[model samples]
Structures are given as C-alpha cells and as structure tokens.
Target: MKKAKAADGKPFQGVQKLSVSLDFYGEKIDVGTLAWSKDERRAYFEYHPDFAEKRLNVSPFKLPVSEGAKAAPNSPFAGLHGMLNDSLPDGWGRLLLDRYLQKLGYDFRLLTPLDRLAYVGQVGMGALRYVPDNSLSKTDDAAIDLDWFAAQAEAVQGEVDEADVDRLLEIQGGSAGVRPKIMIGLNRKTGKFVADDGTDLPEGFDAWLVKFKSNVDPSEIGKEEYAYSLMAKAAGVDMPATKLIETKKGSYFAVQRFDRTESGSAHVQTVSGLLEADHRAPSIDYDTLLKVTRLLTRDERHVRQMFVRMVFNVLAHNRDDHAKNHAFLMAKDGVWHPTPAYDLTLSEGPGGEHNLAVDGEGKNPTKKHILKVAENASIPRAEAEQVFEQVQRAVDRWAEYAKEAGLSERRLQEIDRLLNKRGPTTAPDVDISPSP
Candidate 1:
C-alpha cells in the first residue's frame, strides 16, 4: 500500500500500481499498468509516455487513454462510463459498498480503492472491465417501483440502517458524486418508474435517473435542469435528451442513462472539478480546452462542434459552463468523441465571469475574440460563421423553447431579457441593456 496527501494535505492510502486487463467487447486488451498516487488522489497512466494521457483522481485503476472516436465506447472506463459517476449514488453507493463487504464477512472500512474497483465487476459502464471478480452474478433486471426505491434510498442516505436495503445499496457505491439518484424505468402502462434490479419492467417505461433534492438546489431544481436541457438542445448544443419525471411530490428532472439500455452498455468518462484538468480552478480557457479536445479526439469536425457550443454558451448566457461539464466518449473500437453537453444553467460564475475564458477574454468576449478562437482552433471561417448563425437563430427562439419547457411567462421574459442584451463588451463589464 502507498500513502500520500492531497493538495490540501489530506491523507489517503492506496495501492501504487496494479496490472489490469480490460475485456473490451469480446477481446482482451491490456490497459497496461496503473499507479495511484500516494494520496490516491490521482491515477497516472503510461500507454507509452509519448502517447499516454494521465487521468487524475478519476478511478482507483488508471485506464489508458486512446484517440479512436468509437473505440471502447462500452469499456467500464469509457466515455459513457463517466455519466455513471453521476448516475451511481455516491452516499447511497458508499453505504451499499460497506454493507456488501460486511455481508461477505470482509473488513468493509479496511478495503482499499483496488477492492472498490474489483466490486464493479463486469457490470460497470463503458467497455472497460477490471480483473478477477467473485464470479459474475445475474444482475437484477426487474422493474421495481421508483417511489419505493426513492423512499428506500432516501432512508438509507439519511440513516443507513434500513431493512431489506442491502442489495440496492451495494449497487450504489460503484459510482461517485453526492447526488442521491437511483436507476429506474418507467412503466408505459402505469406511468410509474421502476428500479432496474434484474427483472422485467412492466410495458412502456424505459431507463432514467430519478434525482432527489440536493444541498445546493431546490426540489424543482430537476425541473429547471430539464428546462435547461431543452433550451440547450434548441440552442444547437449537442445534448442527450431529457424529460421531467412527474412524481406525486413534484416533477423530477431525469436524464437518460447514456451507459445502458435493455440490451447492453456504452462507454463513459467522468470530467469533473475534482480532477480531469482540475475543473474547480478557473484558469483553463476555451482555447486550451479546444486544443486538448483536438489532441484527444484529433477530429477537426468534433473540435468545430465543440467551438460552436462554446460560442452558444457565451451568447446564450449559460455561464455554468465549466470544465467538468465537458466530456469525451469512447466506443468499443476505442474511438473517442465528445459526449453530449450537460450540467448547463444560467449562473453568474465566480465573480460573474466565465470559469473558462474565451480566447483569453472572459468578461466581455466580442465576436472578434470568438473568431480568433475559430481560426486558432483550425475551424474554417465559413464553417464557424455558419455554426454561429445557427446558434444565434436558435437562441433567438429561446421564448419558444422556454414555453415548451413549461417556464412561466415571467421566467421566459427574464431569460429573454438577458439573452437579447449586448454580450460581454469588455473584459469585466457585462452589458445588460435591453436590445434594440
């Protein structure tokens, strides 16, 4: 075991390196060796240092990086797998992880990160699979009631000691983050969401993430997220489809799980503030982000697509756009591409400026700055202009989209008021005057 400290001097102990074999699709591919830093805060990977990428504090097992857009899309550590980071219940999953180990008569707290990696088995997201399981068990595919499971998860999250909560809780720890959500399916006939526990779901409903309230947002926060998803889509951003799950209490925001379907899995990757270029830090610019996207994806089209979204985010006043909100997805063949945009919202960033500056200009990025980024990022002028025009046209219809999202007339007018104003005119000044 290796021991190290986080940047804040917090102590963490973990294995330094372990040989890992990935069952990518049907073939066996070696992800090479992985080493956890002394603090277990970062995972350093070497797939030939010349071409390797280091994914930090992501997972206990450091998976190798690849450049193929479709390659290993379903590998446990693949692109879609990152969404699992959000889908899998963090607090709930932790309780389950501990209880599962306890049930197995193992030291739950003594288990290392490697042990946690092993718990994911073959059922993990993406296409990457870790080694040596306790043998695979058929996962529960039954459609359990969502209200019931939400009640159960809420109980466990609040008090950990709930009856008949063992199996569900174990499934929770396999992912990270602090959200209390459970994977469920809606019954087409009954209009109820059921947890996927290895059984048949009643006809009509499909997979979803039923989220609960968090410390930072209100209960209707999910509704706002749903509205944001619709607005983002209407604004020409590539986004996974979203819907509002109407519970007895209120409408809950639900996003389709990119990692799973009735048949199989998709690759995922987690790009967040805790790691993956340190999203919490407000130093990364869209230029650097674009460059990284080009380096990792190597697809000029994807780069151009990303650039278009950046411009849309800026002009549309979706300021919650930060580093972690962007992700790259991988396919079974090891191909890599940008995942759909998510976690978008209208927010006044740290001090009301974008966390990621636009071509070194954050507060008042002009059209010139955006064009400069297009040129530097190898985006052709004609293509950049076309994308900009498309986004502008969609944004112009924000009222239409907002109404579609069921926003009140007052709310729609408020957002419209912000969108129509002149965008950042200077580095520090945001022009909020009503547009002509």
Candidate 2:
C-alpha cells in the first residue's frame, strides 16, 4: 500500500504563514494569522479584526488580544506564542513525527515551528485550528485493535523496521505527554474503537485517549493510573472519566477527552502554555498555580479546586505535577474555568521532588507547607484544612482503590507504604527557597 503524505497531497515543505481559527461545534471563527520571518528566525501573530472586536482574550497573559503583529518572548516557546506552542506535540508525538518524516527523506531538524503547527492542523487538543493543515491522515473509518496498536507502539519505541509509522501518526492526533498513546472514538455500548483524526465521528462514538506503557514503565502502570483517577475524584478533585482497557497483551489506561463536548470542542490552555513556563523543569509552585487559577477563572471555587489537587498530589506522592499537567478550559462566551485534573499518577520528578513546589518546599512538603501555600494564595484557613483532610482520607484508602484496579498485593503494599511515609506532617521552620 502507498503511504500517505504529511499534508494532504502537498509535499512536506516548510510553512511561511498559516491562518488560525476557532472551531466551536462545526462553526469556524477566524482568530488570526501567523507569519514566520526568516531574518528574525521568529513568528509574529496578528489577531483578526473581527476577533479583536470581540475582545476574547485567547491567551490572557502572554498573547492577549492586541492590535498589530505581536512577537512572543524567545526564551520559553522558541518565538511562537505559548498558546500556539501548546498545539504542537512534544515527547512521544514529536518522536513519532520525526521518525515518520525521516522515512520520507526529510530532515526533521530542518522543519520550522510553523511547519509543526501545520502538521497539528485542526486536530490538536484545544479549539485552535491551523490551515493549510499539513497533518498526515486519510479518511478510513475502520475499527481499531488496541492490542495491535500497542504492539506497534512497542515496536516503534524499539526502532523495529516493520512498525506502521503512517498508522501511528494518523491515530496519535498530535497529543502531548511522554507515554505512547492514540486518539480514538470509542463506542461504549458496543466496545468498539475507531481512529479519531479530528473529523466527525460515527454515531454512538465519543473521543477518548488511550495510553500504552513505555519500556521503562512498570507492568501495572495502567491499573495504577486508573486507581489514581478514582482516588483523585474521591478526594474532590474534578476528574474526567477514566477506564482501564484490559487486553491479552496488557492493560492500557484511557481517559475521555475533556476538550470535546457533545455540542462542540472547547479551548484549553495549559499553565505551561498560558505562562510560557517550561514543563521540563521546575518553574512555578502551588502558590503560583492557585493565584493563576483565581486570576484566569475569577472563581474562588476554582482556586479551591487547585488547592485540592495540590493536596492530593503531595499526599499521594505524584511528584510529576508539572505546569502542563494543569489547564483551564474556555467556554464559547470566552469564560475560563479550571479543567478537570489529569495526568495524576505515581512519579518521581527531576530529583524525587515535586515539579511545582509547595510554599518553597519541594523535597518534603508537609501540612505546614501546604497551609503556607494556601495562606499565600488567600484561601481561607478553615476551607484549606477541610480540603486537605478530604484528600487525605481518600488517599488513605489506597489499598481499596488498588484492589479495585486489580493491582498485585506487593505493588499495592509498596504504594501504601510510600503514601504513609509521605502523609501530611508539620515540619520545623527552615529557610525557604524561592520558587524554581
């Protein structure tokens, strides 16, 4: 069979200018235009006149609604605005795209950021859509085999020659994160899965993202993540629906796409994207997260929601809680709200410390540190304490959630011991370090 090209029938060349739009339901609203300047080696964006009149701040902090062409800071997002940068896939998705392009006799390094945005096209996580979309895919509504795709993912990671690069790229949907995953439209009633390529889905299907384990991951990572999702919800952290799809090959963790709704797609901006903060290293702290949540959503309830998530992460030992892991969703009216908590799992960040520190405490944040962060964020003491206790109680029942997830006793005990060891405590006064 002949392989598909990267951007429709067009050969993969670099993109100079791309049009941006917002896709709500099936309606497309022109947002802006992006132009790449070769001399400056950066991209400039100009908001559409109509969009500017609406004054819907797509990126309030970094790329707010403004007249004339605007250039983003160079350090964080490589000249592109943070909001647009969020649309490009990183980690696993980048790896797959690079490998696929290499097979087509193209040097991945030669492609500019605009070229990447072209590949992201309309299928990215948020409501943003790019045109002259160079994204590689064809319309084929065939049922998906998770087990087969899982094997292919493993093969690609292993750099085996027979891995189906085109198929993988078609299904990846330009998603972020390190785990090898695919975007699919699932029919719960019939237990059927189809490739979700940002197109209209068949009836009875909903968009979902499924994750397959990497070589270094534990055997039961899927079940453990499913358990964590349940635990997070129990602790009052807003979470999207999750499931553990078990196959003869292995169990894969799946979560329904919160960016997609029955009515249309919602705009999502990660803390990393909104602030241009890099997720690869420690940058912000819980206090910053809370403050941003309050500022963007203008809802104390959302601030409280962030606090609950912070408490859950600290107590559950999910240290990989980076900026990108948290996000805000925008309604059609341009109102922003905290997105449901995601990427909650057991992880040891850069140095066995939380990616986003708590009141300047990263290595060993305790109740004192949590409370200090709450105080800084202006959350009421009584309310913060209530939220902490609620998360604590849910985390205390690790064994129960683990059992429901069908985790091995040894694994369950290991996590239980870790949870107990990291349980909230009051530490002595120490010189607090500045947020990284």
Candidate 3:
C-alpha cells in the first residue's frame, strides 16, 4: 500500500500490489502477484512459479498460467483483469462501498481497482483472497435483524444519509447483483440466522445470502423468485436451495451460498470473468456459452446442463441471462464444473430482450433459434428437444408454482401472459441435421 498527499494534505492510501491465494477447505495455494502501473494506467499479474507448475488454470482463457507478467486488457473490466475484477463488488455492493467511503471522507473517484481489491481482502466471494488486507470491517457475529437491515437498505437505496453505514457495509458482505443483500449463517433446523462475515460459522449454521427488494422490485418479488426457483428445479435445472424469509415488514429471498462449503470455500469464476466478457451488454451468445462449457469442463454432461439452463431461461421468461449470472466451480484438483443456476427471475433485460441472444436472435427467439444453438454446440437434436420440452412443461405449470409461492392472482396472471406471449413452445419440423 502507498500513501499520497491529497489536495488538503491528507494522506490517501492506495494498494500498489497484492498477493493472491486460493483457499480450498483451509488449504491455501498461492496464485500470483498483482501490481499496478501508475505510468501505464493498468495492472499486471504474474503467476507464482509453483502455481504455474501445477497447471491448475485458474482462469483458462484470459489469465492462463504463464511465466511472465501480463498487462490486463483495457476494455472489458476497467484496468483490472477479469479474475480480480470478479473479487470486487458491483451494483449493490459497489453502491454500499461508495456510500461508506464517502461517509469516511474518501474520494470515491480517486480509488483505483487495486484499492477496491484490497478492501475486498479476504471477504470476497469464491476462494480467492487478497493481501495486505485493508478491509474496512471485521467479522461481526451479531444477531441477525432482517427487518432492521431491510429498512437500512431502503434508506441506502433512497440516497438517505445513513449514520450506520459501517454496519450496513459489514452486513452487505461484498455481494454482487442489483438488489441489496446480506451474508448470513442460517440454522435450518431452528430458522435462526447469524451474521456471516465470510469467516467460520457457528456449529449447525450454513452460509446463505438473503436478498432485500430494490426500489424497482415488486412487493412480492421474493415470492416470485422463490416460485421461479421451484419451476427451474422442476425443469431439471440445478439450483441451490432457496427460501423465502417472511418478516413482519416483508418477505425476503434467501439462497445457500454455493461458493462456501461445509469444509471450505469453492473457487467460482463467472463466465464474464473467465472470458473477460462484459456482462452489462450482449457480449456473447448461448452458442459461445455452451462451447465454453464444453471446452472448460470437457464434459458432455456439463454441456447438456448448460443447454437445460438456457432453455429454462428462455421458457421461464428470464431475460436477465447475463454472463455474470452463469458461473463454474473449480475443485481442489483444478477440475471445473458448472455451478448451480442463480439469479433466475423475470427480467426485461436491456430493452426487453435477452442479455444473451439465441442464434443471434434476442427478442422473440423461437424453437428454431434455440435448436440452432444446440446444433452448433453439438448437442443431439433429440436431447435438445427433450430438454426444451421438459423446461416448457415446467413453465406451463406456472399457476401451480405461483399459488404455492402465495403470489397474488394479478401478478400471477400478468406473468402468465408474458410467458405465453413468447409464442409456441412446440419444436418445428425443420431439419436439424448437420450441414456438409
């Protein structure tokens, strides 16, 4: 960390270099060193020689294990590499950090990506941890207060100056996504939650993420998402266990943290980080997604799993299928596999189109476009059709899920209309044979 004099002669501390490590169930593997170049206006990373020898391929495509230091590209993820950028928070997390830093008299505009990573320190998602640790808060083992936190989240979102910004940031747990959420340890047996500061939890407690509604979200957003999770699971899409935490104020949605395990943490990298693709826009298509799954995992089952998720996203009316929403988990042996699906909900995306298009068709992608992507990805036509039908059948029973979730008839009927408006779910008679 380096300190420079600000305009008022106050010292502004910035992180110049950070050591990166991967922690798998208490075992640590030193990954590399990241250094910022003031002259070049970018950051460079080099894999530790030992880690390079292991050939773990933490980031297979953009940040593959190499001998020499490499500068990160300028475009997609600001000046930081996608892997490191993944450790930094975006959306709600960024908002919380910005507000907290402003309250501390720090200029948010002057902080570089490296500084942000240092703040993330050891509490970021996945297994990667950065040092020297300059994180703002310690592990807060306080009792869980969902209603209070929800009110505070609303205050933060409304831009109301909050005196408990530190507490808010602490509970925020450096989570990503557009909605305000907190990391907690939930005792499933007792339905009790404890604050999870990214550290070891009490016995019988499991790490979970609880989401609060944003200003734009509907009143029954939690119920709706819970319903989607049910439908997705029924469609054969792998999903983490989800719950709707009913409170005196409102209901909140919670899901088990896939990155954390009973023994240790799992190394998770989003498609955005792996491919260095921007998730804010339509940077890649489902064809690339399936191909990436095939290439990375080298497993046909994972490929089929990706196909099912894509089909579920389309049929379930989930257009927020951005790159960041899809992720893969790497084991201690460095073997990679697709993580369970998350962030499955109704979305209009950017201008009411899917963030990831199907066969170059974003709006109104029919069965033809869907099957075309499957064919290009080498998924058998019969299997693809079966997967599509499975997902469509699950979606067709939306009323059951909505009722189970206790959603209003008005909201349920509205979603039904939007879902059915996507045209017929039956596969056309077009030939899906490979072309010569």
Candidate 4:
C-alpha cells in the first residue's frame, strides 16, 4: 500500500504536520495532527477542522495512533509510544517490517513510522482501523500449523534473513508483541488452527494470535503466565480464558484474542492509542489512565475494572504491567470497554515501580493511596476494599498456582525474592506464599 490521506486530500506528513482521523466502528470520532517538533523531542495531535469538536493535544510522537494513520513516520505509521507502540509487534514485528521493506525493494532503515502503521492494517490492538487496508488470508478463518510457525520464527531469528521476515509479515501482518505471532482460527471439529490472511476461510474457524516465545524467555514462562491468568481472574480482573497448547517441544501460552469475534474479525484498542499516549516511557501515570477511563467510558464499572487490574499487578508483583499491557476494547457498535487482560507475569519493572504509576506514586504505593484514588473516582469504599481483599488473597496463593504450572524452583525463588522485597506494607492484608 500507499499512504492514507487526510480530509483535505493530502498525504499525511511525519516531521512537519500529523493529521489523521480516529475511525471506530466505521465512524470518525476525531481528527488531529500527529505532529513532532524539528528536534523530535516532543509530539502533538489536535482535531481536524472537519470535526465540530474542540481540538486537544494528544501526544508528542510520530504516528502515535493505530490504523487510520500511516505506517511509516511521515505516513500513517503508529508511533512507538504508549498504546500504539504496544500494538505494533516489537522484536518480531520490527524484524518482519525490515524484511517486508527489503522485499518491496526499499531500505528498512529508510521506511518511515507511518509506513509501519499502514502495514499494521487491522491486525493492531484495540478497535482503531488504519488506512489503505489490512492484509488477511484469502480464507476468512483456516487451520494453521503452529509447529511450522515456530520453526519459521526460529529460522528468521537465527538467520536474520529479510526474506523470511517479509514472508512472516505477509503471512501474519497485524499483531502487537515481542514474540513472532500469526492470526489463526481453530476448527472446532478438526481441532486444527488456521491462518486467516484477511480472506475466505476453510470454515469452522475464526482469527486468533499464536505467539512464539523467544529463546531468552524461560521454558516455564507460559506456565507462569497461565498461573497469572488464573490468579488475575480470582482477583476480579477481566481476563480472556488462557490455555496451554502442549506441543512436543513444550507448552505455549495461548489467550483467546479479545479483539476477535466469532466471525474472525477484531476490535482492539490500547490505552496508548485511546489517549494518544506513549507506552515505551514513564510519561503516563495510573491516575491519568484512570481519569481517561472515566472520560472515555463514562462508566464507573470500567473504572473499577481498571482498579482491579492495578491492584492485581501491584499485589502479584507484575511490575511490567506498563501502559500498553492494559487496554480498552471497542465493539462493532462503537462502544469501548476494557478488554480481557493478557501479558501478566512476575515482573519487576524499571526501578521496582510500575511502568505506569498509581496516582503518580510508584515505590511503596499503599492501600491508603489506592483508596484515595477510588474516592476521587467516586468508587465506593466497599467496592474498593473488596478489590484490595480479593487481590491480596490471589497473590497469597501464588505458590500453589506456580507449582501447578510447574515453574522451576530457582525461577520461583527469584520471583519470590522480588515479591518479598516489595515489603509487607504493600499488601498488609495478605501473607506471602511460602516458596519451596
């Protein structure tokens, strides 16, 4: 594809001016300039003149939003901040982008951020749609070979071949994560997963993302994530049902895609894209996220969901729960809600505080801090207390879930050490599960 245009009938620019519309459920909510200053130190987005709404500064980055923007920086490429960055596949997607560029006879180094956003098409997280079009298999939903995907991922990663990367992007063009992933639809009858490249399907299947873990990821990483999911559910966080896909090599962590429907289409929105925020840095605070949730959803229920997730991350010691990891989903009807949680793990983020803070407080966030936030957001004291209690219980049972998931002793101990180091004050209501 080519660059998506603004309402003024001009191609979108990167360095000078950024103008793109937010398309949700086929309606344009707002349009703004995704502009970056000459130094690239700051970026901003404002509403287009076509819309009757007031203009607001979204962010300071190139192509910060998903589809409806450009792929390369000067094009509709989604920037590498907040939500859009999370939606764009990192380690694997970057590799594929380079490969795709080489195949198109363009230098990967020369491709702009907007170029990348165009390529993301419909495969990005959340409900935002990009311009030009999304790449899907001719078949709507078909069975795919997970093992083959794994092998190809390894070949690309090991050899760093542009051809393989290009092929991979062509095969699975729209995903957001560090792992090499492909969208597949499983046949209920045949028990096979199908790769749908935006086309007709073999029948009895819809779209799903099959992720391959990198070598740096420990073997038990899948198991631990599964455990985390169970704990998150217990803590009242909305999480998609997760399963362990057992293969001869090992088990792969598989979460049902929140964006996809039974028809195999998707509706994903990251916190980054909704607020035009950045996910890579420490710019946004949890309070800002909470405020935005209320502003966008206008439902206290959604805010509560956000609160539960925050408590679960803090209590579970999953500090890697950055802005991107948390997201809101948009429906075909145009309503946005919090999507089922994924990417939960035992993580100690930058400097032992959350990648996204709790009301501007990071280290040593207390129950009092959480309650104060709840009160400010009009969350009832009883509900807020319930969230704290449930999460505390779930974190206290970590060892049981970890053991069931078969985490190695050393790895479990390492996570336990980090958990303990966070101090008892974080969750005075719960006791640390004994590590074996």
Candidate 5:
C-alpha cells in the first residue's frame, strides 16, 4: 500500500497499482493491470496479450478490447474512467473507509484512488476484482447497531468529524452510491440477515443490500423508496424483490442483490461506464440510453423496459436518475440485458432538472417527449402508450402509496404536488412548469 496527496495537500494512503482479474465460474482470467500516474490523478490499464482474444468488453462502450495501455480520455472523472471508478465506493462507503483508516492510525488523506480499488478486493459487486488486495479485515462486529450505524452515517454525511461509529466500515465496507448501505446475507426461508464477509454466502442465504437514511434524507425515505419499488413493479418496470427492515426508530429499505447467485456472481456494467460518460456531468440523455440498449440487447422488450424506467424516473419525481443509476447485467454466456432497477426514490437532480433529457427536453418532458424516445427506439407507439398509462396510473396513486409508506403529510403533499405537475401528465391543457 502507498499513500497519495490530494491537491489540497492532505496525505492519504491508497494503492498505487493493482492487477485486474475476471472470474468465470471457478476459473480466473488475467484481464489486465492498472497503474496510477505520477500525480495519482490519472490511471492507465493494459490488457495482457495472452488474454486479448478471449477478453470480454467489460466496458464495451469505452474500454474495449485493446493491446496497449490506455489512459482516460478526459479528467471529468478525476482522470479515471467511470467503470473503474465504479469499483471504488463513494458517499457513505467512502466515509466508512476513511473512518476505518483513521482508526488504524493511518492518514486517510493519503488514500489514493487505486488504493481504494485495492480495498474493494474480490468482494465488490460485478465481476471485476483487484489483486494485491489491500482490503481491511473485519475489526469488530459487536459495535454495528442499527441506531448507532444510522447515527454515525448521518453524522458522517453532516460532516461531523467527532461522531464516528465503530465497525460500520466493516459491515458496509464495499458498497457504492450516496446512501448508507450494508451488504448482508439473508436466509431465504427465514428472512434473517447476517453480515456478509465478502465471500460465497452460506447455503440457504442470499446476499441483500440494506439502505439506511442519510442525513439529508427524510426519516421515511426507506418506506418511500419501498413504495416506489411497488409502484415500479406495477408499471411493468423490472424491480428486485424489496422489503423494509423496521427498527423502533425507523424503517430501512432492503433489496436483494441482482448480481449475486448462490454459486457465484455476475458481471455488471452501468450505462455511464459502458459509454464512458461521466455520471456527474449529465451529458447523455435517455435517447442515447435507448439506442445503446437496442444495440447491445438487440431486443425490443429490453428497449421497452428501458423506456418504462425513463417514464418512472420522470413521473415519480426521481430526477436523480444519473447515468450510474442505469445498469445492465452480463451472464456467463456473454449475453447482456437490463438489470432490475434499483435506487428508485424521489430526489432533486442538478439544478432540479432530469439528468437525462427526453426528446431534447430536460426541463418539462411530457407524453410527447416520451413517445419520441419510444419511436426513435422503434418501439411501437401503442406499446409505449400502454407503458405511459400504466406508469401514470401507479403514479396517480402516489397519495395512497405515500400514506402506506408512512411518509409525513408535509412530504407527501410536497411530492404529490411535483408528481401532478409532471409534464408527462396526459390530461389536456396541463402545462407543467420548467425544471427548477
């Protein structure tokens, strides 16, 4: 392990280089090697000549089959490609790692991005594994309590350096996204959950990720997301089986891991990674997504599914639908398709506009914009309209969903107002305001 310094002059420990591998069943293949540039801001990866022919395009959009080492084309993503960056945790997971590093008497500030991937080891989601593993071991599990974990996660998000929860970094050590989530193995029959150890889960149990509330989130965010899950399912959008873990204080959203299987794991590729589009930049739109889905899956059903997700994201007030939020899965046979949707919730996007524009309209996309996307994807107008009606029907029931979700009346009204004002509303003469 080595240390790197941030531009701000803070020293943190991180890995300088790592060997990347892909697992197919019990077989391991040397995919490539990654190294950090002198400044630690840029990264370069080269495929092993021997594995070139058999190599899969883990990130087909940008990092395709190649011989020479290729550096990231731009610095929008810290000079690292989105696919590799996905291997590193962010938000809550980053905070956990930093805290754990601090507890170990190492300056987390010295942590480099590659070092972050090293910590991901072989336990991260998707099929990518970083070797020369520098991952931290389980320090202690006794201190990982629901209330304490929630408190610490909230404190970390609030930038309260004094408040830190012990052992949290171990339980939720390898997750991504802004929310505080823990990777737990659940007993399929008993609905029991146990801490995951970054290995093959024991028999009778499957891996599930549980998400807790962030400091900026509403207390009922869990229930709200669960309700959205239900709504998504109603609209024919693919959604993983979801449940709510209730504590005396609140409820937490839990979703089964779509990438994990009893025998092994599957490869995952996000829209942003596959296209090399930076999720933070909001450069790509839904039209691009549809085209990519068509080109990759070659299946109209998959294209239509992607269309449904776009509708749900728009009508449900889930403006935080950035590129990373959309993903696909690859089977061992090398086939790709849309994965079940996760991260469904009400959120305000950058400048309160949808990260993905619809038919050149990001501010106030209506039925016309959606129809245009479907038409462009070659999905029949009739089928697309059915999707719109189904999604709108479910969204119209937002009040009922909110009531069942136990959301406060104030939040319920606030969200309901936004939903009603959506440009996708089919009602005649309803002109929605522009994105705020």
Candidate 6:
C-alpha cells in the first residue's frame, strides 16, 4: 500500500509571500503581507489598509503599529520572521517536523518557515490561517487512547519502530514546548477524545492540548502540573480549563485551547513575538511585560493578573516563566488581552535563576522583588501587596496540594523543600513601597 503523503505537500525553497488572513467571527479578514525578498534577508510583514484601520497590533514592537512594510532583524528569529516563527514548534514540534519530512522523502534542509506553517496550516493556535493548506487528515472518528498514544510517542522518541510516524505527526501538529504533546478534540463532559480530522472538530468537542512525559521528566510530571493548575486557580491566577487525563501508563496534563471555540478563534502573539525578544534566555523583564500588558490590554486588571502570576512563579518555584510562555490573545472584537497562565510547574530555570527577572533580581526573587516589578509597571504598591498575600496563601498550602495531586511523598517533599526555601511562612503586610 502507498504510504499516506505528508500533510505538507512540498517544501518551500525561497517563497516570497504567503497569504495571511484573520478568521474574524467566521469571516476571513485580509491582513496584509507575509513576505521575503532578495533585498531583505529576514522575512518581513506589513498590515493591510483594512487591518490597520482596526488598530489591532499583531506585533507592537518589531512590526509597526502604523500601516507600512517592516522587516524584522534576523538576529533572534533565525531566517524566519518573529511572528511567523512563533507559529513554528520549538523543541518537540521540530522533532516531529524532521520525522515527518523524512517519512515523506523530502529534504529537511529545504524546509522553510512557510513550509512549516503550511503543515501547521489552520491547525496552529490562534487565528492566523495559511493558504495552500496541506495539513489535511481524514479521520473517521478513530478511537483515541491516551495510554496508547503515550507509548507510541515514547517509542518514536526511543529506539523503536517507524510505523506510527504519520499518526504522531498528524496529532502533534504545532505543539510547542519541551515535552511532547498533541492537539486533540476533547469532550470534557463525556470524557471522550475525537481524533481531529485536521480541519474542524466534531460537534460537542473542544480543542485540547495533551502533554506527555519527556525523557528528562519524572513520572509524576503530569500530576504535578495538574496540581499547579489547581493551585493557580486557587491563588486567583486566571488559567484556562485544565484536566488530568489518567491512563494506565500515567496521568497527563491537558488544558483547553483558550484561543479556540466553535464559532471563531483568537489571534495569539507571544511576548517573544511582540517584543522580538529571544526566548532562549533572559532577554526581557517582567516589569516590561506588565507595562506591555497595560499598553496592549489597556486594563489595569490585566496588569494585575500578570502581577499575580509573577508572584505565583516566585512562591511556587515556577522559575521557567519565560517570555514565550506568556502571551496576549486578540479577541474577535479586536481587543487584546493577557492569555491565561499555562506551562506552570516546577522549574529550576537557567542557572537556577528565574527566566524573567523580578525587578531585575532573578537569582532570588522574594515578595520584595515582586513588589518592585509592580512599582516599575506603575501598579500601586498596595495592590501588588494584596496579590502577593493571595498567591502566598495558595502556595502555603503546597503540602495539601501535593496530597490532592496524589504525588509520592518523595516527590512531594522534593518540591516541598524547594517551595519552602523560595516562599516564606507568611508574606508580611508591610507597606513595601517601590524603590526610587
């Protein structure tokens, strides 16, 4: 039997322009250019006359807020544009791309950012949809067993078989992060998984992203993440709907696609995309992130929400709060808002420091540092104190959360010690004014 063709039909050697659009309330809005040329080494983009009229900045920093052509400096974004690069998968997704390319007998070296976006097609997070779509998978509501998929993904990662390569790539499209994950159609009420046909979800199912254990992770990672989600919600941090899918192998953490619904999708631009900051290191600060939140969302509440996350990251020991992990979502109303917190778990960060500095202090970011960031963002110090107390209360219950997540005592204590050192017994209700 002939092997199924790779979803990406062909490689793009040096494509100039890619048609870009926004799926606004089920209608396509022609949003200007996604192009490259000989004169420009890095890919460039510009807003169409109509999109600029709406005043929705796709990227506020590198790309102009006004209507005109702009080329991104090719330092951080490789050869691809930063915004478009955000659409490409980083760690696991890149691995899947290589595997898929080899399976299709295509030269992986010829792979361009646009080509990767073609495979991402309409399946990528948020509203940007690519033309010449090639990521089409015909599925007849195939049974989806998380346990089976987990094993298959493991096999592909290990010294295993090549038979399940296509299935893996199809399900794992455009999933970012270090851990291997897949985008699936999930019916939360019914506890059913609908194999995504790569175009639309079957009725009654919402888009969900399910994660598996990477080689470096412990067995309880999913449980730990689920525990963090619960803690975040209790801490008054806005997070998307999350569930822990337990299988025979182990539990997996899954979060609802906040950017997707039945009628329309939200446009997403990561902080890295917005600022063209290299996500690989500590290129940006949380102070600037909060200010950006205020600038884009124009709401003190969103900035406050971000402040709450910064506190949680510190107290809960979630030091891997990198730029790419934070994002802003554009509603169909053309308003931008801070996305719900995800990717929250135990992380040592780079050099055991926070990925984003809290008031320029990364190695040891206490409540004092958290308040400093708020002051830098011009948030009233009192509100930051309230946020600090609230997140501290939630984090103070780490032992209870560990039990709730059913983590082993050894694993629980490991995290418990880390949090204890990071978080104090109680956050003082002192008037810690912002530093001058």
TM-score of candidate 6 relative to the true fold: 0.89
Candidate 1 lDDT: 0.57
Error of 1 at 329 (Å): 2.0
Q: Against the correct fold, how does model 5 do in TM-score?
A: 0.88
Taken over the whole model, the C-alpha lDDT of each candidate is: 0.57, 0.86, 0.85, 0.61, 0.77, 0.77
Ranking by TM-score: 3, 2, 6, 5, 4, 1
**lDDT tens digits by residue: candidate 1, 109-171:** 654444455556454545445554432254555545555655665565565555445646533
Looking at model 6, the pairs that clash are none
Model 4: per-residue Cα lDDT over 59-158, one tens digit each: 2233332334332232123333343444455667777776654545554564445456556655454444455443433443344556767778877777
- Model 5, position 263: C-alpha lDDT score: 49
Candidate 5 lDDT tens digits, 335-411: 78999998888777787689999998877888999999888888889988999999999998887877776767766
Q: Write the per-residue lDDT of candidate 2 for residues 235-332, one digit (tens) a residue.
A: 99999989889888788899999999898888899999999999889999888898898889899889888899999999988888999889999987
TM per model? 0.67, 0.93, 0.94, 0.73, 0.88, 0.89
TM-score of candidate 2 relative to the true fold: 0.93
Worst 10 residues of 5 by lDDT: 427-436
Candidate 4 ranges with C-alpha deviation above 4 Å = 1-89, 103-105, 122-143, 188-190, 263-266, 409-436
Superior candidate under lDDT, 1 versus 5: 5
What RMSD value applies to candidate 2? 5.4
Q: What value of lDDT does candidate 2 attain over all alpha carbons?
A: 0.86
Instruction: Give the alpha carbon lDDT tens digit for every residue of 1-436 in model 3.
Output: 3544545668877889999998876779899999998877789999998997666888999998879999998778778899888888898889888887777667787788898888888888998999988776664456778998889989998888854677777767668888888999999999998998876789999999999888877778889999999999999999999998988888888999999987798889999999999998889989999999999999999999999999998887788899999999998788999999999988767777888999999988889999999999988899999999999999999989999998898778778766764334453321111100
Model 5, stretches more than 4 Å misplaced? 1-14, 53-55, 102-110, 139-144, 158-166, 408-414, 421-436
**Residue 103 in model 5: shift from native, Å?**
4.5
When 1 and 5 are scored with TM-score, the better candidate is 5
